[model samples]
Target chain A: MTFEVENVSKTFVSGDSDEEVIALKDINLTIETGEFVSFVGPSGCGKTTTLRIIEGFEKPTEGTVKDDGELVTGPSNQRGFIFQNYSLFPWLNVIDNVIFGLNINGKPEKESKKRAMEYLKTVGLEDFAERYPSELSGGMKQRVAIIRSLINDSKSLLMDETFSALDIQTKHKLQNQILKICKEQKKTIIFVTHDIDEAVYLSDRIVVFSRRPGMVKKIFEIKMDHPRDRQCQEFEDLVSEVIEMIGEVEED
Target chain B: MKKFRNEYTKETLILPIILIIIWYIVCDVFQLIPSFMFPGPTDVANSFVRLAVSGKLFKDVFDTLYKVLFGMLLASVVGITFGIILGWSKRLETLCKLVISILRPIPPIAWIPFSIIWFGIGIGPAVFIIFMGCVFPILISTIDGVHRTDPVLIEAAESFGASNSQMLTEVIVPSSLPYIVSGLKVAIGIALMCTISGEMIGSSSGIGYMILTSTSLFDTGSTVVGMLVIGIIGIIFDYIFTKIQERIFW
Candidate 1:
């Protein structure tokens, strides 16, 4: 499940006027199997656009994304996507939402339901299985969204600012939970965020981008072990370093 | 809250009771308006009881209901089917837009002459008119509902490899249920109107036919009864649909 973004560039033309807006230009990056990579940059840096290209939601103008050496063309269940607002189907209850991918793929209903319950239990949401998305709190809903993707056994997850809407305490709790789940399941995650602390906290590698018409400014390898303390001096120092890089990019 | 609701219900009855009393005074007690032209409350009541006892009122009511229900069923099936197809394909919808707009503005009653010519006098013409009246609202609302489907939800479905049909059934249809139900509510009212007018113009049976016959015979009491019965039916259908709308939204 390694992904290679080779010389990818995207240009969006305005509908009324023919003015071209370059979202990403000459982007090149390789994410290894089971790696947790975060794309961190300023707003409109095309970090999200780049992530979308890899997920096969948007096509790149110049190049292609290779998922395990197969050229990405369109959306596939093999790669799950998590949106910032937790786009769980409001009509579906928690268990139904989690099992949606499985159901659509024609898995046996009883088996899918059983497996969905197991996943919900891991997130301590088994009690909320019968409740619809509207009944759940923000954090709970996001957790359901994550479990929904996880249950599909997607080799990679393309998350676009998945936790940006949560309160601080909820965000930290989810970040910890996601870290544990991805580590245990060995699923590759390509996370997009403006939060440097979140990137440092979750990602194995943080790929920083330059402002609009974005390309890789730098890539930082976090050589920290699991359950890294945010209060630790090493964590604080790394956070500051990434912040400095982004600050310099902002000035430019 | 309970007491306030009770007071609200009581308040609603006051005006209707006052209107009935005024009508009684004008047409029955004083005998100002002739009985042949406009029946009093007592005359209408006696006419209602006579029709009910003879069973012609129930038969006419059933005939009208049958036409309305049959036509609505046809309209819903066709409307929802076409709506989903048109809603999904932008090109198809664009191509049909002009034709639909042209057809939609023509009132269902306006089609009565052609309907009578095509289907002949009886249930056929009435049903056709009802179908015509009901279909457009349903089709328009369903199309609107489809268009209003959240893009993110569609993206999520696509990402999970949901096929086009699967997307329509599982995601699109459920998301649009509220709008569809509302459209049905609108269609029901239109269907009733079409049934009455259609029956009055082209049919041999139904509440509208009874009203037409009674009025022409100068039996104003029976005519009033027919009108009141239609109003009651409309209220019942509206109440049922409102409950359905509430349930689906939740």
Candidate 2:
């Protein structure tokens, strides 16, 4: 099912001031099923806001987001969101954290555990299943957070700078893992990132956003397959293109 | 574990020993205060032995323990439940905020008169006072705990399709556990204090009653013994609670 964001504009009012701040202005996009798309922009560009709208966490002041012609009302398991903060439950162990969505969805305990373990095993964290989030490293915790959403069989994954907090090496490693998993599952992804390189490397298409009062400046389709070489001329070219687009937005 | 236990034992014993030596020097050697007014450490020890043999110490300990435990149980049940509800519902919190603000600052001792009038002189009033003392701390802590929960966690849970009740039980409650636990710690201290105060003001039994009667009769050693028991019990309760906190939260 295709997801459509139509003429969406969001306005935010500060608690103290009467002045209005338009965070997003008349943004529009269509995300085809099983396609990988990335949103790249500077801070305050409303890339995160756009992702939030898609997940139905925040309603746009104008326009609508439809998933296969169904109006998105509120947060649903159908559109999974991976936060910048790992947001793994500190109290729950790795396995339990991974199975959280299934638990909330009322799946039987045995089946949920089996599904959680399978995801954990794929991430090679099955051995750490009983360990709490505090014991896991940052990358491991984020993996659990991803699996937490994935086990629900969400139609799309909306990542909000999920790797921005991690070190470069760990971030790249996780990017590879996420690419592999998304490809294997053929799940649609709308990844938000400030890193143009990441956007070019992972996304089938990149939506470059302008600064404040965020509007789509350009959309670049990457004509490459999975496991795109980061150092390759074309990959670097696309990354430079995305950077130039954002740089132009900044200049404007 | 064994190393930790040994260190803990050694650390705990050192202060009490030093304090006892100082007490011996002041009251026994120097005879700073008259024997009837302030007892020596040895005298307090002798009083403890005497009370233990006579079964009065155990009985008073039991009486005080029963009141604090019973009151704390009731307080926990009511406090945590109401705290979660109020913390989640802004309307409920707004309705109760003024009442809580008005009631919270008025110490459990302030409710003693009403408790006595309402429930009479013995365990009833003591329990009521202790419940009042314990409940507010637990309730406030629970509210703060739930309120202070990381917004990111709530957002994550919502995106995972957690129902409101599921959010409360799984995310809100468990995440707030540290706050609730610390609250329970405060409640334990307050509960113990209320139990003793309640007993001292009106009851014929309990450690507080014994201390009151002994002090009035100039039985300073017995009074010191009661005071020491309460202090030691408070320390033990704190120690146990800390252990539980370490196991659960850390």
Candidate 3:
């Protein structure tokens, strides 16, 4: 089972006069089941736009995205989104925030609470289940935001700069934990970020994007094994290589 | 025991205490005005005791409370409903601007003539005037609050499958609560002002009517007492509203 896209493009109108802004351009990609893919690009290079299209938050002006076997429509339970800003509802306490998807999607509050606690435990935040989102640190809030999405057990996870708000140390810690969880659960994830080293580190493959009205610049398959040794020559070489590719693209 | 002091709570008390001291020193200690012209706090209290003994003060206070509470209740229900609809629906909001512009400038007291014409000189007209006074402040602030909610929240909830009704019930209303509380606080003051004003012009048994009759008879001491009664009652009701607001909001 794989998710595939063919010739997808999206354009938005800027104003009343209808000045067109192309956010994404002719894109083609595929991800094998349970694969973790990272899209690395400069700001406004359409990495987030591409993920939004795949998640059905926006419709492509051209082409189609097929998941397993069907076309993408408006957001479905099959897709889960984790925002960079950790969009946990600030007014809601942690348990209520975690169970938000369940409540909004019509799950009974009692059952949703049970599943929410289990998911929060998976993120090691069961103790914070009753605290408000504002009471959490940035890293902890991000974890809660992630678990909120994960609680639904969606078929695919769409992460838009998921760990960018975190410091390097917290980033690595959360990334490792997330990798382990996704691997154990066999969950496919498509993440967007600008960090080249991070892209090479966590992703099964990295999709490099060109600047504005972004098109797929290149796709690199990382041969590194799970629980990757960051010091390994192969991992370092891929990181340097991807960094250089991004540098050249940004300069152009 | 060692927690930091709340500077804000202390600041709120400074103005009231300063005003009280100034009022006392000017009227009582300094003797700037004659006792009959500017009675001291003791004189006001004596008048209160005299009126209470006669049992007329209670009836006047009760009549004022009944009118203000009933009118304010009507305003709260209608104001919140319209405010939510205006805030939530773009087309409705656009349409409302013209109507709001027309209705907002006319003061509730200014509508006294029309209210009297429509409902006559009684509690009905008096209550209608209070409702008119309170509704705009509540509605405008509530709409402002609803419009200020983060758009990202709406998008996130929509992504998670919140329907329009669920979004309004769960997201929009709760988010606008602080503004609504502040609005209601302002509305309470306006409600008190309108109820007294309506009674002065139209009603037969309120503190405002008592103030009118005392002034007509030139009982300056009783007139001072009537004014004091209205001011003290206004403060009490405002204090109660603030307590309710704090309980509901945070």
Residue A246 local lDDT, model 3: 84
Candidate 1 RMSD computed on C-alpha atoms after optimal superposition onto the true structure: 2.5
Q: Stretches of candidate 1 above 4 Å error? A: B1-8
Task: Indicate the residue-level lDDT of A31 in model 2.
Answer: 91
**Could you say which candidate leads in lDDT?**
1
Predicted chain A of candidate 2: TM-score: 0.95
Return the number of clashes found in candidate 2: 0
Give me the TM-scores of chain B across the candidates. 0.96, 0.92, 0.83
Please identify model 3 stretches exceeding 4 Å from their true place: A15-18, A66-73, B1-38, B229-250
Q: Tens digit of lDDT per residue, candidate 1, span B10-128?
A: 77989999999999999999999999989999999999999999999999999999999999999999999899889889999999999999999999999999999999998999999
| lDDT, candidates in the order shown | 0.91, 0.89, 0.84
Which predicted model would earn the best DockQ? Answer: 2
Sliding window of 10 residues with minimal summed lDDT for model 2 chain B:
B1-10
Best by TM-score: 1
Please provide, for model 1 over A3-115, each residue's C-alpha lDDT reduced to its tens digit, 9 standing for 90 to 100.
99999999999899999988899999999998999999888899999998998888999998999999999999989999988589988899999999999999998999999
lDDT of 2 by residue, B1-250 (tens): 1111212667778998998899899999999979897899888888889999999999999999999999999999999999999999999999999999999999899998999899987899999999999999999999999998888899898988889989999899998898898899999999889988999986889999999999889888999889889998998988888877787773
What does TM-score give for chain A of every model? 0.96, 0.95, 0.93
